[model samples]
Target: MSESFQLRVNDVEYPLSVDQGRNLLGVIRTEIGLTGTKEGCDDCECGACMVLIDGQPVNSCSYLAVQAQGREITTVEGLAEGDELDRLQRNLLEVGGVQCGFCTPGMLMSATALLAEHDDPSDDEIRIGLSGNLCRCTGYARIIEAVRRTADGA
Candidate 1:
Protein backbone atom coordinates (compact mmCIF):
# COMPACT_ATOMS: atom_id res chain seq x y z
CA MET A 1 0.00 0.00 0.00
CA SER A 2 1.11 3.53 -0.73
CA GLU A 3 1.06 6.14 2.00
CA SER A 4 1.89 9.77 2.35
CA PHE A 5 5.52 10.27 3.17
CA GLN A 6 7.98 13.13 3.25
CA LEU A 7 11.74 13.09 2.94
CA ARG A 8 14.22 15.88 3.54
CA VAL A 9 16.99 15.34 1.04
CA ASN A 10 19.89 17.64 0.41
CA ASP A 11 18.08 20.18 2.60
CA VAL A 12 15.04 20.11 0.33
CA GLU A 13 11.70 18.61 1.14
CA TYR A 14 10.03 16.04 -1.05
CA PRO A 15 6.56 14.73 -0.42
CA LEU A 16 5.88 11.29 -1.80
CA SER A 17 3.32 8.55 -1.71
CA VAL A 18 5.15 5.26 -1.62
CA ASP A 19 4.93 1.75 -0.29
CA GLN A 20 6.03 1.45 3.30
CA GLY A 21 8.51 -1.27 2.47
CA ARG A 22 10.18 0.68 -0.32
CA ASN A 23 13.89 1.13 0.05
CA LEU A 24 15.31 4.64 0.42
CA LEU A 25 17.65 4.17 -2.53
CA GLY A 26 14.75 3.65 -4.93
CA VAL A 27 12.84 6.49 -3.45
CA ILE A 28 15.85 8.77 -3.64
CA ARG A 29 16.67 7.83 -7.21
CA THR A 30 13.19 7.39 -8.66
CA GLU A 31 10.65 9.21 -6.57
CA ILE A 32 12.81 12.21 -5.71
CA GLY A 33 14.79 12.13 -8.99
CA LEU A 34 18.23 11.96 -7.42
CA THR A 35 20.40 9.30 -9.04
CA GLY A 36 23.84 9.74 -7.52
CA THR A 37 23.14 6.90 -5.09
CA LYS A 38 23.75 3.61 -6.90
CA GLU A 39 22.30 0.18 -6.28
CA GLY A 40 25.11 -2.30 -6.47
CA CYS A 41 24.20 -5.35 -4.43
CA ASP A 42 20.55 -5.33 -3.56
CA ASP A 43 21.32 -7.54 -0.61
CA CYS A 44 23.22 -4.82 1.29
CA GLU A 45 26.53 -6.66 0.89
CA CYS A 46 27.87 -3.73 -1.11
CA GLY A 47 28.05 -0.14 0.04
CA ALA A 48 27.26 1.40 -3.34
CA CYS A 49 23.84 2.25 -2.04
CA MET A 50 25.08 4.14 0.98
CA VAL A 51 23.63 7.50 1.98
CA LEU A 52 23.72 9.74 5.00
CA ILE A 53 20.93 9.80 7.51
CA ASP A 54 21.28 12.36 10.28
CA GLY A 55 24.99 12.57 9.40
CA GLN A 56 25.49 8.80 9.73
CA PRO A 57 26.28 6.50 6.84
CA VAL A 58 23.54 4.01 6.08
CA ASN A 59 23.00 1.30 3.50
CA SER A 60 20.01 2.85 1.80
CA CYS A 61 19.27 -0.29 -0.18
CA SER A 62 18.22 -2.14 2.93
CA TYR A 63 16.75 0.80 4.83
CA LEU A 64 13.02 1.34 4.62
CA ALA A 65 12.03 4.65 3.02
CA VAL A 66 9.37 5.18 5.65
CA GLN A 67 11.92 5.07 8.41
CA ALA A 68 13.65 8.16 7.00
CA GLN A 69 10.60 10.39 7.31
CA GLY A 70 11.83 12.77 9.96
CA ARG A 71 15.57 12.49 9.51
CA GLU A 72 17.90 14.45 7.24
CA ILE A 73 18.90 12.53 4.12
CA THR A 74 21.99 13.22 2.07
CA THR A 75 23.04 11.63 -1.21
CA VAL A 76 26.18 11.91 -3.25
CA GLU A 77 24.54 14.67 -5.22
CA GLY A 78 24.22 16.64 -2.04
CA LEU A 79 27.95 16.83 -1.56
CA ALA A 80 28.51 19.82 -3.78
CA GLU A 81 27.61 23.47 -3.89
CA GLY A 82 26.07 25.20 -6.90
CA ASP A 83 28.90 24.65 -9.34
CA GLU A 84 31.63 23.64 -6.94
CA LEU A 85 32.58 20.18 -5.72
CA ASP A 86 33.01 19.28 -2.11
CA ARG A 87 36.56 19.29 -0.84
CA LEU A 88 36.52 15.51 -0.60
CA GLN A 89 35.30 15.18 -4.17
CA ARG A 90 38.06 17.45 -5.37
CA ASN A 91 40.59 15.54 -3.28
CA LEU A 92 39.42 12.22 -4.71
CA LEU A 93 39.83 13.49 -8.22
CA GLU A 94 43.19 15.10 -7.51
CA VAL A 95 44.43 11.94 -5.77
CA GLY A 96 43.04 9.66 -8.50
CA GLY A 97 40.80 7.91 -6.03
CA VAL A 98 37.92 7.75 -8.49
CA GLN A 99 38.11 5.43 -11.50
CA CYS A 100 34.97 3.66 -12.68
CA GLY A 101 33.21 5.79 -10.02
CA PHE A 102 30.65 3.15 -9.01
CA CYS A 103 31.86 3.04 -5.43
CA THR A 104 32.89 6.67 -5.26
CA PRO A 105 29.53 7.88 -4.02
CA GLY A 106 29.37 5.43 -1.15
CA MET A 107 32.99 6.06 -0.29
CA LEU A 108 32.41 9.78 -0.24
CA MET A 109 29.34 9.37 1.93
CA SER A 110 31.12 7.10 4.39
CA ALA A 111 34.17 9.33 4.45
CA THR A 112 31.95 12.34 4.98
CA ALA A 113 30.36 10.75 7.99
CA LEU A 114 33.74 9.73 9.28
CA LEU A 115 35.24 13.16 8.88
CA ALA A 116 32.25 14.70 10.55
CA GLU A 117 32.87 12.47 13.53
CA HIS A 118 36.64 12.75 13.45
CA ASP A 119 38.44 15.89 12.39
CA ASP A 120 41.78 14.16 12.18
CA PRO A 121 41.23 10.50 11.43
CA SER A 122 44.20 8.17 11.41
CA ASP A 123 45.12 5.80 8.58
CA ASP A 124 43.43 2.95 10.43
CA GLU A 125 40.45 5.15 11.17
CA ILE A 126 40.13 6.10 7.51
CA ARG A 127 40.31 2.45 6.50
CA ILE A 128 37.69 1.54 9.07
CA GLY A 129 35.59 4.49 7.97
CA LEU A 130 35.65 3.37 4.37
CA SER A 131 35.48 -0.34 5.13
CA GLY A 132 31.94 -0.55 3.83
CA ASN A 133 32.55 0.92 0.38
CA LEU A 134 34.38 -1.18 -2.20
CA CYS A 135 36.29 0.10 -5.19
CA ARG A 136 37.24 -2.29 -7.97
CA CYS A 137 39.49 0.10 -9.89
CA THR A 138 41.71 1.75 -7.36
CA GLY A 139 43.52 -0.38 -4.76
CA TYR A 140 42.34 2.10 -2.09
CA ALA A 141 45.76 3.53 -1.37
CA ARG A 142 44.91 6.71 -3.26
CA ILE A 143 41.47 6.83 -1.69
CA ILE A 144 43.00 6.58 1.73
CA GLU A 145 45.51 9.21 0.79
CA ALA A 146 42.76 11.48 -0.39
CA VAL A 147 40.90 11.09 2.89
CA ARG A 148 44.12 11.67 4.77
CA ARG A 149 44.84 14.73 2.74
CA THR A 150 41.39 16.06 3.40
CA ALA A 151 41.79 15.39 7.08
CA ASP A 152 45.14 17.13 7.09
CA GLY A 153 43.72 20.15 5.25
CA ALA A 154 46.35 19.66 2.57
Candidate 2:
Protein backbone atom coordinates (compact mmCIF):
# COMPACT_ATOMS: atom_id res chain seq x y z
CA MET A 1 0.00 0.00 0.00
CA SER A 2 1.15 3.53 -0.77
CA GLU A 3 1.23 6.16 1.93
CA SER A 4 0.55 9.84 1.37
CA PHE A 5 2.60 12.55 3.00
CA GLN A 6 3.06 16.26 2.77
CA LEU A 7 6.48 17.66 1.99
CA ARG A 8 7.57 21.26 1.75
CA VAL A 9 10.12 21.74 -1.01
CA ASN A 10 11.61 25.08 -1.86
CA ASP A 11 8.86 26.65 0.26
CA VAL A 12 6.14 24.92 -1.69
CA GLU A 13 4.11 22.25 0.00
CA TYR A 14 3.47 19.12 -2.05
CA PRO A 15 1.23 16.18 -1.31
CA LEU A 16 2.90 12.97 -2.37
CA SER A 17 1.59 9.42 -2.39
CA VAL A 18 4.75 7.41 -2.24
CA ASP A 19 5.57 3.79 -1.70
CA GLN A 20 6.14 3.02 1.93
CA GLY A 21 9.81 2.39 1.33
CA ARG A 22 10.63 4.91 -1.36
CA ASN A 23 13.78 6.91 -0.97
CA LEU A 24 13.65 10.69 -0.88
CA LEU A 25 15.75 11.26 -3.98
CA GLY A 26 13.40 9.24 -6.21
CA VAL A 27 10.32 10.85 -4.79
CA ILE A 28 11.74 14.34 -5.12
CA ARG A 29 12.84 13.81 -8.70
CA THR A 30 10.11 11.56 -10.03
CA GLU A 31 7.10 12.67 -8.03
CA ILE A 32 7.90 16.32 -7.52
CA GLY A 33 9.92 16.75 -10.73
CA LEU A 34 12.84 18.30 -8.90
CA THR A 35 15.76 16.86 -10.84
CA GLY A 36 18.40 19.06 -9.31
CA THR A 37 18.91 16.46 -6.55
CA LYS A 38 21.18 13.96 -8.20
CA GLU A 39 21.54 10.31 -7.19
CA GLY A 40 25.12 9.07 -7.04
CA CYS A 41 26.49 6.03 -5.21
CA ASP A 42 23.08 5.74 -3.50
CA ASP A 43 25.05 4.69 -0.44
CA CYS A 44 25.41 8.08 1.19
CA GLU A 45 29.13 8.21 0.43
CA CYS A 46 29.17 10.47 -2.63
CA GLY A 47 26.82 13.11 -1.23
CA ALA A 48 25.42 13.61 -4.70
CA CYS A 49 21.93 13.45 -3.31
CA MET A 50 22.46 15.96 -0.56
CA VAL A 51 19.47 18.05 0.53
CA LEU A 52 18.65 20.14 3.54
CA ILE A 53 16.14 18.62 5.89
CA ASP A 54 15.20 21.31 8.34
CA GLY A 55 18.47 23.12 7.56
CA GLN A 56 20.61 20.00 7.98
CA PRO A 57 22.30 18.14 5.14
CA VAL A 58 21.28 14.53 4.43
CA ASN A 59 21.83 12.04 1.68
CA SER A 60 18.39 11.92 0.11
CA CYS A 61 19.15 8.81 -1.87
CA SER A 62 19.29 6.92 1.39
CA TYR A 63 16.74 8.92 3.29
CA LEU A 64 13.25 7.51 3.28
CA ALA A 65 10.55 9.74 1.89
CA VAL A 66 8.28 9.14 4.85
CA GLN A 67 11.04 10.27 7.14
CA ALA A 68 10.76 13.78 5.68
CA GLN A 69 7.27 14.32 7.00
CA GLY A 70 6.72 17.76 8.51
CA ARG A 71 10.33 18.69 7.73
CA GLU A 72 11.41 21.52 5.46
CA ILE A 73 13.40 20.16 2.56
CA THR A 74 15.59 22.41 0.46
CA THR A 75 16.95 21.32 -2.89
CA VAL A 76 19.21 23.01 -5.38
CA GLU A 77 16.20 24.25 -7.29
CA GLY A 78 15.14 26.02 -4.11
CA LEU A 79 18.35 27.99 -3.71
CA ALA A 80 17.51 30.53 -6.40
CA GLU A 81 15.23 33.53 -6.46
CA GLY A 82 13.38 33.55 -9.77
CA ASP A 83 16.15 34.31 -12.26
CA GLU A 84 18.78 35.24 -9.71
CA LEU A 85 21.09 32.64 -8.26
CA ASP A 86 21.82 32.35 -4.58
CA ARG A 87 25.09 33.84 -3.33
CA LEU A 88 26.65 30.39 -3.16
CA GLN A 89 25.43 29.59 -6.63
CA ARG A 90 26.90 32.75 -8.06
CA ASN A 91 30.15 32.10 -6.24
CA LEU A 92 30.32 28.60 -7.67
CA LEU A 93 30.03 29.96 -11.17
CA GLU A 94 32.58 32.68 -10.57
CA VAL A 95 35.04 30.29 -8.92
CA GLY A 96 34.60 27.53 -11.48
CA GLY A 97 33.34 25.12 -8.84
CA VAL A 98 31.04 23.33 -11.22
CA GLN A 99 32.35 20.81 -13.69
CA CYS A 100 30.10 17.88 -14.62
CA GLY A 101 27.43 19.43 -12.36
CA PHE A 102 26.43 16.13 -10.83
CA CYS A 103 27.93 16.96 -7.48
CA THR A 104 27.41 20.69 -7.77
CA PRO A 105 23.90 20.60 -6.37
CA GLY A 106 24.93 18.61 -3.33
CA MET A 107 27.94 20.81 -2.76
CA LEU A 108 25.78 23.90 -2.99
CA MET A 109 23.24 22.51 -0.54
CA SER A 110 25.95 21.50 1.93
CA ALA A 111 27.59 24.88 1.67
CA THR A 112 24.26 26.60 2.20
CA ALA A 113 23.67 24.62 5.38
CA LEU A 114 27.17 25.34 6.61
CA LEU A 115 26.90 29.06 5.95
CA ALA A 116 23.57 29.19 7.67
CA GLU A 117 25.19 27.86 10.81
CA HIS A 118 28.44 29.82 10.48
CA ASP A 119 28.24 32.98 8.45
CA ASP A 120 31.99 33.44 8.54
CA PRO A 121 33.29 29.90 8.33
CA SER A 122 37.07 29.44 8.42
CA ASP A 123 38.82 27.51 5.66
CA ASP A 124 39.22 24.46 7.88
CA GLU A 125 35.58 24.61 8.94
CA ILE A 126 34.51 24.96 5.34
CA ARG A 127 36.66 22.01 4.34
CA ILE A 128 35.34 19.88 7.19
CA GLY A 129 31.76 20.93 6.50
CA LEU A 130 32.03 19.92 2.86
CA SER A 131 34.08 16.80 3.42
CA GLY A 132 31.06 14.55 2.96
CA ASN A 133 30.40 15.87 -0.52
CA LEU A 134 32.64 14.30 -3.14
CA CYS A 135 33.20 15.98 -6.47
CA ARG A 136 34.87 14.00 -9.22
CA CYS A 137 35.56 17.15 -11.18
CA THR A 138 37.31 20.37 -10.19
CA GLY A 139 39.27 18.49 -7.52
CA TYR A 140 37.45 20.42 -4.76
CA ALA A 141 39.82 23.42 -4.89
CA ARG A 142 37.34 25.54 -6.80
CA ILE A 143 34.47 24.30 -4.68
CA ILE A 144 36.29 25.26 -1.53
CA GLU A 145 37.13 28.64 -2.99
CA ALA A 146 33.52 29.24 -3.89
CA VAL A 147 32.33 28.51 -0.34
CA ARG A 148 35.06 30.67 1.13
CA ARG A 149 34.15 33.54 -1.16
CA THR A 150 30.50 33.28 -0.29
CA ALA A 151 31.26 33.23 3.42
CA ASP A 152 33.56 36.24 3.03
CA GLY A 153 30.88 38.10 1.08
CA ALA A 154 33.01 38.29 -2.02
lDDT of 2 by residue, 101-128 (tens): 9999999989999999999998899999
Report the poorest 10 consecutive residues by lDDT, candidate 1.
37-46
Most accurate candidate by lDDT: 1
Q: Which candidate comes out best when scored by TM-score? A: 1
lDDT of 2: 0.93
lDDT of 2 at 82: 96
- Between which residue pairs do clashes occur in model 1? none
Residue 79, candidate 2: Cα error in Å is 0.5
* After superposition, candidate 2 runs with Cα above 4 Å error: none
In candidate 2, clashing pairs total 0
Give the Cα lDDT of each candidate: 0.94, 0.93
Q: How many clashing pairs in candidate 1?
A: 0
- Give the Cα error of residue 152 in candidate 2, in Å: 0.8
